[model samples]
Target: MGAEHYPPPWFSVAPMMEWTDNHYRTLARLISKKAWLYSEMLAAETIVYQTGNLDRFLAYGPEQHPIVLQIGGNNLENLAKATQLATPYGYDEINFNCGCPSPRVAGHGCFGVRLMLDPKFVAEAMCVIAANTNVPVSVKCRIGLDDHDSYNELCDFIYKVSSQSPTRHFIIHSRKALLNGISPADNRRIPPLKYEYYYALLRDFPDLQFTINGGINSIDEVNAARLEGAHGVMLGRAAYSNPWQILGLVDSAVYGAPLRSITRRQVLEQYQVYGDSVVRMYGLKPHIRDVMKPLLGLFHAEPRNVVWKRKVDAALLRCTTIKSILEETLGEIPDRVLDAPLTEVPSGSTDTFIKAKSLLPPPYTVSEEELL
Candidate 1:
């Protein structure tokens, strides 16, 4: 594909650690074909030095296309090697990770948010990557780091990088990264989100596409950002933990396309077909759990789903095949899953979704239609 043919992402699923793997991406893709998907972050060292076959990092189904493969590293040569290797796998774009504040990413690996201090190096790396690959290259970054948390510094970083290379698409996490004394979890919360920084980026770099990230939950919020002139909005844990909420509604709400009139139950029926295919291809050793974990979030906010949730939780312990898990929940799978409206969120976060699961257990008391 030519550079002119590349489809600009208007909305994307953020590259999370374990949450956005191929199975989950496949499920999300089924929900919204237009939204760009991201693979979990892979270390460039693993790609260039450690792995003999690139498929270990590059493997994905064709339906998962328009996907972005995010790689992390500070070594220019290794990053170049990884980019060159990944391009032939048909990824629509490549995103560099510069916003991850985890110690393993920033401290131990010397990449991620630490790169914010050296935008010149980032520009140089983007040049190397662009030289090696034909697809659109992008950077996902934080607004600033510990002491460099100034708006001007943010502008400087943007100017230095985009000035040197054609990598104009950027995903900004909208927060400064704290490099010390905090867990990665705290880093996500402790640093206050300054969305103004992102708006400023959009205003200052008119030629660049800026996708704002950090704490955006609902389709309403996504629409607000689009109205505010953001090129895109990236949803992380919110998308993963409540896959149906954002993915289910995004088709009609964000894009002009009509909603996929299919119910959540029908979607699961499709997901079951996908799970079966995965198990048939990779066998039941580990793929079943991989297929199942992404689904725990789908039942969020549905009444009487506790019964269905408990069945899946137990399936993780008792079942080896996706078939068994599907069978376990078959009769229990509520019509609500088939008939529930795909509209606004029902007022709770993913954390609440986790806490509210599994309140009911036993020889299953709730009737199927009662769930409706």
Candidate 2:
């Protein structure tokens, strides 16, 4: 293993902003203990500001072991300080966010494939974090940005940033991030993914650990990626939606890693425990709504379970009490979410339905300084 090993060829929860918060991570761990988890990408500046209550950002149940904290920022000193604050919470690794294409991130001067243009800074920042923290420091990045489409440029950029001195593992989201007025949603779909590019990273730079991310939604997609020689596969939304599908089977399916058996009902019950804890601790934020969303996939196939998911959906959308929502929608918690948002599927029309990506925010512009 590189630094520490919990599962071979680890899987990760991509750093989605509001979606992958502590509440969701806790719910996810209840589904799969071994799939590596990460916090939503936090800026070094944000961490410094929140260090007094570092527990807020760093608080994870002990059961969620081998979790990595994903952080962003170009300043080496701030990165080092943030890494120090993170270690006490027992992060297995520290990851720098070089992939996100948000304007807020760009306004602060970080993320986007913009960080790749200055691999030297990324390299030094990694060096500082790796030096200061006992935990491993890694990077999650895109191939390159809008104008830098040439595969050669991306390869050269990775070679420069891998900084193979110690921990040379870099998670490559094999697509270009177009940071214009265009949203982050389109960036994932619009940028043509060359899986060949992922395999090329392994062949060209065998010394570095290359994990493939982006557009990975299913087991078949994951298997195809492996055939291309990716060290590991990373999932963003799919893993979130089908946590059990990936985590429940991934241990056996992908890595021959240890398997844990947890049924669908069992998973839902576990989430309830988490849901209760979240309400007790953080009050109502976003995850109350998210926990309800995943349950929809559970009963989608079964006509009866579909009602439960729909009940959950109504409650979640209304931001109402679980008891009240259950009573109102399913008459008895219905057993699962109706498998699709009631508003969308019940009406079922493109013009009326807000698509999944609509839930995601737009891409950010990189400031001139970050471009440098």
lDDT (tens digit, per residue) of candidate 1 on 100-215: 99898899788999999888799988898889887889999998999898777787788778877778898999889999869988988999887877776765778888998997
> Which parts of model 1 have CA positions greater than 4 angstroms off?
1-7, 280-285, 341-372
- Cα lDDT tens digits, model 2, 170-239, are 8888788888767778877888776556666666777888888988776555655565455788899887
The C-alpha local distance difference test score for the whole of candidate 1 amounts to 0.79
**Poorest stretch of ten by lDDT in candidate 1:** 355-364
Q: What is the C-alpha RMSD of each candidate to the true structure, in Å?
A: 12.8, 8.8
Best by lDDT: 1
lDDT of each: 0.79, 0.67
